[model samples]
Target: MALIITDECINCDVCEPECPNGAISQGDEIYVIEPDLCTECVGHFETSQCVEVCPVDCIITDPDNTETEEQLRAKYERITSDNG
Candidate 1:
């Protein structure tokens, strides 16, 4: 599943750069995760990089965008290929 930044976010700006898929960005209020680009760090790390660096623990799995590990991997591959 993609991760979503909750209103509890402090906007500390730590999670944006940590996202390997460039999915996290500054929203009107807090940071937002683009579900299309998020891979939950599947191709880049053992765990979610954003979740790792978040100070307030405001990041959580987006139930609305639920995806399996295999699906995340496929999305990662697709994103990398588009960039490469």
Candidate 2:
């Protein structure tokens, strides 16, 4: 599954830079995670970097995306491609 940022986010900015996919961003009052871009750090890291770095534990799985490992890899490829 992709990662999500809950309302509990303190806007502490801990999780933003840790996201290799650039899926995390600053929102109006807190941080947000882009489901389409979030890969749970599949190809880049062993686990969800945002979730680990979030100070308030506000980053959680985005149940709606529910991506498989292959799909996450595809997303990772796409993200890196765009980043280049």
Best by lDDT: 1
Best by the TM-score measure: 1
lDDT of 2 by residue, 1-84 (tens): 888888998888788889887788898888888888889999898888887877788777787879889999998998888888
Off by over 4 Å in 2: none
Clashing pairs in 2: none
Per-model lDDT: 0.93, 0.85
**Shift of residue 42 alpha carbon in model 2, Å:** 1.0
Off by over 4 Å in 1: none
TM-score of each: 0.98, 0.90
lDDT of each residue in 24-68, candidate 1, tens digit only = 999999889999999999998999988998889999999999999
7 in model 1: Cα distance from truth in Å? Answer: 0.4
